[model samples]
Target: MKGISILGATGSIGTQTLDVVRNSNDDFKLIGVTANSSVDKMKEIIKEFNPKYIGMMDADSAIKIKEFCLENNFKVQVYSGMEGLIKISTLDEIDIVVTSVVGMIGLKPTIAAIEAKKDIALANKETLVVAGELVMRKAREEGVRILPVDSEHGAIFQALQGNEIKDLKKIILTASGGPFRGKSKDFIKNVTLEEALNHPNWSMGSKITIDSATLMNKGLEVIEAHWLFDCNYESIQVLVHPQSIIHSMVEYRDASIIAQIGSPDMRLPIQYALNYPKRKEKVAKEIDFYEITSLTFEKPDIDTFKCLRLAFDAGKKGGLMPTVLNGANEVAVSLFLNKKIKFLDIADIIEDAMTIFEEYTHNDITIDNIIELDEKVRKYVINKKG
Candidate 1:
């Protein structure tokens, strides 16, 4: 059985990952799990999985979990903070590290896991977006496989199997166009948080839902594709497919497109990552082709959703710019969710942060540098807001 460590164990991806693990009990072992402040959910997961180590990024949450476990007479080791996360990432028995942690915080632990010679199932796009060059290079140097857990990248990976890289032309990434797909800029300006959170095709965490609304999620995926596929930014194109049936497509030089279609269930991709070079049976919604008669695609409105443009610029600029962009967006998204800023302010804040930062190219990025950059960007955003 392959031993696995799941980061962000209480979130949507982490919970679904556990479901996949439950389905393949005989094939996989849950060694460790980590979450960020969801004590109740973490407690439930600990009871079910009985992982050897559990971590909470928030110390108070860890304390709450520890007290609850003690009061309930549960025997489980609990840890807190970044060190705890790193400890779990480097666990000896873990063959695979499933990083579902949201935001730029995932970058360091993911690199640590890769350096430890663990295969990575990456759901955190910010990890790749911020440090794709370093992460992908390190994975290559260590001979570690970084599997894509995001549906778009996973679909592209599935389509690229047994295909020659030389024949690949462009990657077509499909987006749900979010809840504000065809709405005018004026309409979007007045969009409330509830409207933005109402994703048509998928159930996801709030940050991601907001990113989807701003088309920043697609932008991050574009950067992620560049790293995962060893392709240029220009070769990656985003298509607004409202149906979300076609996860993503790969176009060959001969003008043929290979696409992967499935129901918008993250479990399928998560399971695919866990069982590489094999397929497994799991409980998820299956697509019925007859009922869905049409699949249409359109260009994203770059005029309105400026986050996509900002991400592309950062991707092209390379180096620490993407890190700044990711960090700023994370802070901005948090602020927007708290109602400190309006929905459109998310992109505005990111763009401002990107402009104010100096891009540095580092051949060797230590965990320290990643943390420093993350803090610097967060502080920059906060100062700008003040």
Candidate 2:
């Protein structure tokens, strides 16, 4: 059984990853888990998985876990803060680290996992969005397998199983278009947080749900696909597929399109990543073709959802620009989530930050550089909002 560590055990992807582990039939062992202040959920994971190590991004939560473990005689080690996260990620027993944590916070721990020679089941897009080159290079150097856990990237990985990179044409990422697919800017302007969070197809955390509503999730995925598949920005395409039956597709050089189709479930991708090079029993619900429906597609409304456009621009610009884009977006989304800004302002904030940092250049793409840039961008966004 392969030992596994989940870096965000309390989030949407993290819990789904746990389901994958739970159903692995002793093929995998849960070794370590980490979360950000979800003490109640973390308690449940500890009782069920009995992982050897636990990390809480929130210090008070870690103290609480320690107390709970002490009272219950759980005999598990608990750590706190970023150091704790890194420690869990690099545990000696963990052969694979499933990084489902959101935002730039995921970058450092993922790098630590790669450096520790642990194969990565990557669900965090911002890790790549901010430091794709560095992380990918580290994985290559350590001979670590950085598997894609996102549904779209997982589909692309599956479709390219037997194909050579040279035979590949372009990657097609499908977006469900969130809660406001066909709505105009006028309709989106006054949209409440609840309305934006009400995703039509997939259920996710607030940040990503907002990103989806703004079409920025697809944009981030575009950048992620570029890094994962080593494809050019121009070669990546996003189509609005409302049904979400097709997670994603890849077009070959000969114009043959291979699509990975299934129900809009995150578990499928999680299972795929966990069992790389092997296909286990199905853990996700299968799609029913008997319904006899049509799968339609449309171009993403980039003009209305300017975050998507900004992501593309940042990705193409390269260097620290994508870092700025992600960091700023994280802050903007947080502001919107807190009802401090309008939903449409997310793209505007990100764009303004990008514009401010456009001429910025970095000598090296180190973790320090990425983290510093991320901090700077976040501060800039908050100050601008203020």
Candidate 3:
């Protein structure tokens, strides 16, 4: 059995990943699990999986969990903070490290896992959005397998299985377009956080939900597609597919398109990544032909959801521009979620920060440089609200 570790055990993807693991118990083992501050949820996961180690980004939460473990005589090691996360990520028993944490926090642990010779099942888009160059290079150097856990990426990966890289023409990344897909700018202007967080197809965390509403999630996925598939920015295209039945597709030079169609469930992708080079029993429902009348696709309106356009611009520029875009968007989304900024202002803030960083910090592409730039961009965006 291949041992696996989950870095964001309490998260949406993390929880679903566990379900996949549970169903595939004969082939996989849960070696570790982690979360930020979800003590109760973490506790439940710990009891169920009985992982060897657990880490919490929140120090106090780790302490509470450790105390609970000690009192209950549960055999587990609890670690806290970034260093703890790195340690858990590098555990010898874990052959696969599922990086499910939402943002930049997942990057380092993922890199650590790669260095330790653990294959990565990557769900966090920010890890690629910020440091795709460095992360991809490191994975290549270590001969690590960086599997895509996101549904669209996973679909593209599956479609390219038997095909030659040279035969690939383009990747067709699909988006559900969120709950506000058909709404115009004026309609979106007054949209509340509730509406933005209410994703139409996928149940995700608040940050990703907001990103989907703004179409920035698709943008980051495009950048990620560039890194993962070694495709040109021009070749990775995003289409608004409202049905989300076709997770994603790839067009070949031979004029044939291969698509991975399934129910809009994250677990399918997670299971696919977990069992590489092998197809397992299905965890999600298969698409019902009778219930699905038709699948519709449309061009994403860059004018309305300008964050998508900004992401393309940044991805096209390369270097630290994508990092700046991601960092700034994280801050902007945080501000909007806190009711400190308007819904439409999210794109404006990201655009402004991207322009500034592209003009100034575009020269640095090193991991350290990107991390530093990430912090500065976040601070600049946050401090500007004053």
Candidate 4:
């Protein structure tokens, strides 16, 4: 049995990861879990999984979880904040660390797990987006496997099996184009949060949903695929596919394209990460070619979704630029979600931060440097229009 620690045990991917673990019959075991502040959800997960350790990024939430565990005679170690996340990630029993937490917060714990020689099941693309060079190097040094847990990356992983990486031409990542696909900039400016959050294909967290609408999520994935597959940013392409069945495709130098097609379910990738180099009984739904009629593709409107363009620029620059871009986008998206800023302002804020942080694009790629830059960019974006 593989022992795993879930870093964001209460979020969309985290909860679904737990579902995957629960459904498995002794093939996987939960050793640790973490949450930001969802004490109720954390408590339910603890009750169900009985993980040995839990980290609550919010100190107050950790206190509540501790109280509940103590009152119920539940034996579990509960820690709080960033330090807690790192500690649990390095736990001895956890052979696999499922870094599912969104944003750059997952970066540090992922480094911790890699340093501990724990294989990573990476759902948090922001980890690679911000510090791909540093993170991938650390994984290599530690001799730890960094498996892709995102559907697109997982599809590429599956497609590349038994094929030499040297023979690969390019990776084509498919996007659902989100709810705002064909809408022009003028139309998007008037869109509300609910409208942007209404992703047509999959259920995701609010931050990701907003990123999808702006096509910035696809842009970030492009950067991630570059790091995961060790390909050039130019070699990674994105196609706006309305149907998400073809999650992603891999092209060879021989002009052959291999695609991994499946129902739009996150569980497939999550479980595949857990069972690396092995296939298990299916948990999620399979594709029904009979019911599926057509699959259409288009070029994403980078002119309309400037955030996507900004991501490409930052990614191509390749340093602290992507870190600043990810940080700025996070703050901007959070502000838009809270109604503190207009939806279109999200890209504007990111662009501003990118322009300002370009001077530091050559900064050190150390983990500490990345974290410092992430915080600086977030503060810059948060206070720019405040």
Candidate 5:
């Protein structure tokens, strides 16, 4: 059985990961878990999983869970904040660390985990988007396996099972077109937060749902795929597939295309990452093609969703530019979620931040450099006028 630690055990991906572990039937053990301010959810997880280590981003929540564990006679170590995250991530007992946290918060612990020689099941795209070079290098040095847990990246990974990377042509990432797939700029500008959060195919966290509405999520994935696959930005392609059945595709130089098609469930990818190089009994439901009518595709309307265009631009520029883009988008999405800015303003803010930090495009990508730039971009976005 493989030992596992989930860094964000209360989030959507984290909870689903817990489900995978729970049903693994002695194939896996939950060694540690962390969460941000989800005291109730954390308590429930502690009761069930009884992981050896627990980390809470919120100190008070950590205290509460600790007290509950003590009263319940559960022998578990509870910690708080980044320090806690790192400790749990690098625990010697865990063979693999699942970096499933949202935003840039997942980067540090993921790096720490790699340094500790732990394999990574990466669901956090921002970790790669912000510091792909450094993270991938560390993984290589540690001889660690960085598994892709995102559906698109997972699909590409599956399709390339027996194929050689040298024969690869490009990767095709599928997007759900969100709720405003064909809507004009005018329509999107006036779209309410509720509408943006109302995704057609996937049930995700609010932040990601908003990113999907803006198409920035797919753009971020493009940057991530570049790092994970060791492919250039020019070789990555994004298509609008409303059905989401085709999670993603990879094409070879021989003009042959391989695809991983499945229902839009995150568990399949999560379980696949956990049990790498091996296929187990399925957790997600099988796709019934007889009931399905048709699968369709279109070119992503980058003109309408400027965030996607900005992501490609930032990714192509390389270096710390993608860091600036991700930092700005996190703050921008938060602003939109709070009803403080129009949905369109997100791209404007990210683009402006990217332009402001363009001179640092070729700078060295240290963890310190990325964190400093991220802080600067967040402050800039928070203070900028819409």
Candidate 6:
């Protein structure tokens, strides 16, 4: 059985990953699980999987989980903080580390797992967006496989499986166009939190849902594709497919386009990552082609969704620019959710932060440098509001 450690086990991706594991119990074992502060959910997972280790970033939450486990006479080790998450990633028996945690907080543990030679089923795009060069280089040095978990990247990986890299022309990533697809710039400028969170196809965390609405999620995927496929920024293209049936596509130089189609379920991609080079049967939705009328595609409106343009700019700038973009966007999203900033300000804050820190460049992306840059950008954004 392949021992698996799932970071951010309480989130949407984590829950779906556990579902995949549950369906294929004979092929996999849950060795470790980590969450930010969802103690009740973590406790429930621990009771079901009885993983050898569990981690929580919040100390009180971890202690509460430990207490509950003790009350129930359960035997499971509990840990807290970033160190705890890092330790869980390096568990000796773990063959695959699913970095499904959201945000930049996932970077350190993912790096630790790679250093330990654990195969990475990566869902944390921020880890790559902020430090793609460093993470990819470390994976190569350690000879560890960095498998893509995002449906788009996973589709590209599957499409390129048997094809020679030299034959590749470009990667065409599909977007659902989100809930605000055709909204005019004026309409989107006044959008509320509920509208942004209402993703048309994929059910995801709040942050990702917002990113999807703004098309920034697709932009980040472009950066991810560049690193994963060793392609330049020009080789990645984003197309809006409102149906979301086609996760992503790859075009060969010979004018052939290969695409992966599936129901919009996270479990399928998670299972595929776990059982790489193989297929597994699980309880997932099946596509009904007869009932579906048609598939529509359009060009993304970069005029309104400026986040997409900003992300492309960061990716092309390379090095620390992507990190700054990711960091500033994270802070901006938080502010928007808190009602401190308007929805449009999310793009404005990121763009402003990038301009202020233009001198940092892509080569200045040491871990310490990224952490400092992230803090600096957050402070700059917060102060700008005041």
- Each candidate: RMSD to true structure? 1.7, 0.9, 0.9, 0.9, 0.9, 1.0
lDDT of each: 0.90, 0.91, 0.91, 0.90, 0.93, 0.91
> Which lDDT tens digits does candidate 3 get at residues 127-245?
99888988899999999999999999999999999889999999999999888887899999999888788887888999999999999999999999999999998888899999999
- Our tally of clashes for model 6 stands at 2
Q: Which stretches of candidate 2 lie over 4 Å from their true place?
A: none
TM-score of each: 0.96, 0.99, 0.98, 0.98, 0.99, 0.98
**Compared with the true structure, what per-residue lDDT tens digits does model 2 show for residues 1-386?**
99999999999999988888888899999999999999999999999989989999999999999999999999999999999889999999989999999988898899888999999999999999888999888889999999999999999999999999999998999999899999999998999999999999998999999999999999999999999999999899999999999999999999999999988889999898888899989998878898847989999889999889999998998998999999888999999989999989888888888888876635478778887878888888888895
Least well predicted 10-residue stretch by lDDT in candidate 1: 358-367
Model 6 local distance difference test score: 0.91
Tens digit of lDDT per residue, candidate 4, span 1-386? 88889999899999899889988888988989999999999889878888889899999989999999999988999999999899989999889999989998898888889999999999998999988998899999999999999999999999999999999999999999999899888898989999999999999999999999988899899889888999997888889999999999999999999999998999999989899888888989977889999999999899999887888898888878998889988888899899889888989888888889888879888888888888888878777765
- Model 1: lDDT to the true structure: 0.90
lDDT tens digits by residue: candidate 1, 1-386: 99999999889999999999998957999999999998889888878878888889999998998898889777878889998888899999899999999987797799899999999999999988878878899999999999999999999999999999888999999999999998888888878888889999999999999999999999999999999999999999999999988999999999999999999999989999889989888557888888998999999998899999999998898877787788889999988888788888889898888877765434245556767887888998888773
lDDT of 4: 0.90
TM-score for model 4?
A: 0.98
Model 6 lDDT per residue over 264-309, tens place: 8988888899999899986579998997999999999998999999
TM-score of 6: 0.98
Position 110, candidate 1: lDDT: 93
lDDT of 5: 0.93
